[model samples]
Target: MNNYPFGSQAPKSFPAYPKTEFDLESGTAIKRTRKPKNSPFHPLRMIKSFGNRFHHFFKLHPLMGLFLALCFVLALAMILSLYGTQYGVQSGGYVKSDMGFDDYPFSKLQNLVMVAGHSIYTSSSCGKIEKEDSWFLESYQKNPGQAATFVTHIHEGIEIVARDDSALLLFSGGETRRDAGPRSEAQSYWAVADSKGWFGKEESVKWRALTEEHARDSFENLLFSVCRFRELTGTYPQNITFVMENRVGALEKLASDQGEKLTDVM
Candidate 1:
């Protein structure tokens, strides 16, 4: 999937931008003059007022959806035709690792450190990263220092991992905001850390860091990161620490709920 944000410039994770209205607005299409929103003949208000009727456009356009489904089926068929499905998943649950599941090097780590992400960095401009305008913020997140706090968490997670040889640090957050394009909060944090060279602890922390990108809420951040940690390490962490600045009570509650003692509260 194309998980990078819009624009020609993006993180190295994805090489090419995908199709979208943003592309049209970015001059990929022929430039054309359009009426301003404040114009008297603006039609969006009326269309939006239709509510469910407006949404019926999808129901009204079934052919396109059918074509998409057909394309997906064809793509799956093509892959199956080529690969032959010899390694297809079986119905039974996972077998014992014999000794241990060590395919991923993270299997050696025994502790987990998660940094819950709050926002994504949306700026293609290098200068605007520290600015509030560069993020897709909710009403509560419009404050000036909010963006900086997120950076602090990223740095703090790296520092924690650097200090603990057994710890595997995870940047935990999902693609929660549609307005922020396709970037996940976890990916955004990791990218920022990469851009900053892991805040001068690159060699010590880079290998320990990973991302849990499917979590969308506070509890999910902890739960999903634990599942990811177990997947990587083949065993649940003995201790889990969170690095969200000024937030400890929630993490403590979640840790207790997950049946782990919070040894160090920060």
Candidate 2:
């Protein structure tokens, strides 16, 4: 009774699905969800709600609203000022230091030990400066073994700085020798110290060792170095020390002029 034979082709009938019926979820969900009160998705609504509350408060007590706004502004200003102070450019130099203690070693080190330089090293030769002819000596300092004393002073200063972790060593003098072609005594001492390898404390004390090159006399050595210390460290020293006698009572008089006391090394 079939139109086609069993071994031949055959066709069957079925209901075709509509496109909307196939896409049922998009057309209509099983359960609809209502947005919660104070929904985060509605920012403009939240701002409008805040404005309404503020308006109500302002209408009730205008003085209170003014006071509250003033307080908020003050607090915001305080916060900005604090951040600005913490993050602003300091000193405004071409080479400005960061607002951290790590880069400022001299500030952390509180004590100063000054070595008064006596002569300029006038050597055209290199390195063996423990002898007499290497220095630009005065007539009085023309004797043998006199140049070695300068090296000794540098060594002693380095040793002291090495022993005290909080001390900075300074070689202080100026270019008093006009005939020596602008070489300063402070520079000479530093060069000698460098040649000596900072007396074996190169790693520990060499970096702390520096020179004050504008001191033309023993008094200037003290005065200029103190100013130099303040310039570099941003604070005055708690104490100062150097090895020299009151040869002409100038140091004693300088101390008296400032209303301070000096303990005589003699």
Measured by TM-score, the strongest candidate is 1
* Model 2, runs deviating above 4 Å: 1-105, 245-248, 256-266
Superposed by TM-score, candidate 1 places the C-alpha of residue 194 at a distance from the truth, in angstroms, of 0.8
Query: 1-266, model 2: which lDDT tens digit per residue?
Result: 75776553656545465433344567542444667788357889989999999999999999999999999999999999876665655357334334454455578887777888888998876476877888888899898888777777777788778888987788889999999988898888888888788889999998888889999888898888777776667666666777553453677677667654333321
TM-score of decoy 1: 0.60
TM-scores, each model vs. reference: 0.60, 0.58
Question: By lDDT, who's the top model here?
Answer: 1
RMSD of each: 30.0, 15.3
TM-score of model 2 (CA atoms) = 0.58
lDDT score, candidate 1, position 134: 82
Q: After superposition, how far is residue 44 of candidate 1 from its true place, in Å?
A: 53
lDDT of 2 at 138: 89
lDDT of 1 by residue, 1-266 (tens): 87876788775565355443335456564445676778476588877767565357548877875786699899999998655433433246433344447675778899989898888889885455677888888999999888877777787788888899999999999999998888999988898899888889999889889999999877788889989998888899998888764556666787767799554423
